[model samples]
Target: MSNPFSYPTTPHVRKHGPAGYREWENYRPWLRDEFDFRCVYCLCREKWGRRRSSWVVEHLVPREKAQHLALEYSNLVYACSSCNSAKSAKWVPDPCQHAYGQLVYVTNDGKIHAKNADGRKFIRTLALDEDDLTNYREMWLHILQSWKKHEPERYRQCMSFPDNLPDLTQKIPPNNTKPEGANNCCYQQRKQNKLPEIYG
Candidate 1:
């Protein structure tokens, strides 16, 4: 489902880079397009944010185990900030903590595939087939359907939360850049801080 062409390579990553960096350079846009920039796990739209960077490129098998299979498109996917971070460098789950062994990474057709038993355990431990995430998938499905029905209003709403009137308003002025610059692209900071300017 990956579109091989749209991927971009960073200069540093093009030379000497970690597997994560290389995989992200060549694989991110492809996966983003394939999955519509939605989290492969939670099904939420993602943006590149500061604070250690969000929306990480997740590998089913930790890089060490994936050396031979690193380029396998099916083995790579996009994960949300929390999910990817929580899974840091792990190839699989701790089975002793969860029953039912581990759920193998299945392709779109739902075939069992895994690099090791630990991977299976990781899946099981995390409840990778979580009902919450499934519900999120359905939520994204509804959003897609709704977007097609009404573009203008939906687009406005989508541009509202996480963003706001001031950020992109015409009143911002010509030749004037964002008051706080790129890192402040979203109002997430205000929202996160529960600032009076945003909440009040």
Candidate 2:
């Protein structure tokens, strides 16, 4: 059985300012912690992307649909650029409550299997079967297999429960200054590049 704690259904306890200038900055850390730095859809991380901004605060229910929930912590999701762009304004099975093993499973072929009709719809909606994602999962599978064989201790640690997980934190110099970028413009760029427009 998949670990329940692997995905979150509850909102983080951290304080997040209302949606305004740089409000997401205050909530980013909380979302990161809630999702364990993985995309709710593809499980991708900023570390896997070309930029730290690759992962973003995607609204589970798009702000266009529910403007009131724009900054509602419970409605926020941590998603990678591709998944976020693909899921711009559509609804899918909530990864938190609906991501149990049967609904979404990884097959031996390193493909994501949406076991039910809803799962199939979700997969189709997000194009989760794309070759790049298949190959990405396969690569990670191989790496995991190698780790299990050659680095049992590390593998065990990686497989441990979230509460039992070790502290992998590292200190970095503080930067309280805000970045000069308007983060939301990336979605417009993606749409202009002929990516599917979900909001329209």
Candidate 3:
């Protein structure tokens, strides 16, 4: 089984680029799919808890720091409430431009380790190594390992995509630079039976 907490080996590439929404909250659905239903910073999945309330839309540049980019599609990311709050108004390396997998690694004990200066900054800024979160990761790792071993079905549920994937094709932003991206949204792929049941 793949480590669900494992970060991407390469920088994230944005798939959906919905733009010109009056409120940033309107981009929630798009951000959800864009980040694969996980917190971009912590890899916390929607499968872990209450779907809607547990997640939030985070600004990469922060609204107070750069009001001009507040509504920019490229500046938005999906994050869990914990990470969002911890990272409030602080800039770390851009996940889109920097591959976090290269910066940090998680041990079986659930402690996060940094590779260098940027990695250290990322972890420190988000308090990723704090006891509460470290223990949380450790607990989940054990739980998932057990589930995968004894409850295959449960493991599948935890590892699979949520049932409520948004249909970007049905949404219309005020202006979309990548209108063609709608066709490739998760909902569309799932509709065509191209979506995988489990993600590594």
Give the better candidate number (1 or 3) by TM-score.
Answer: 3
Model 1: runs farther than 4 Å from truth? 1-23, 47-53, 89-200
- Alpha-carbon RMSD of each model: 14.8, 12.9, 1.6
Mind giving the per-residue lDDT tens digits that candidate 1 earns over 65-183?
A: 76866655446666676667666666532222222123344333222344466545555544455555444444444554466467745543442233321222222222322223322
**Whole-model alpha-carbon lDDT for candidate 2:** 0.55
Give the distance in Å from residue 136's predicted Cα in candidate 3 to where it truly belongs.
Answer: 1.3
Per-residue lDDT value at 87 in model 2: 79
Higher-scoring candidate on lDDT, 1 or 2: 2
User: What are the TM-scores, per candidate, against the unseen true structure?
Assistant: 0.37, 0.63, 0.95
TM-score preference between candidates 1 and 2, better one: 2
Error (Å) of candidate 2 at residue 15 is: 12
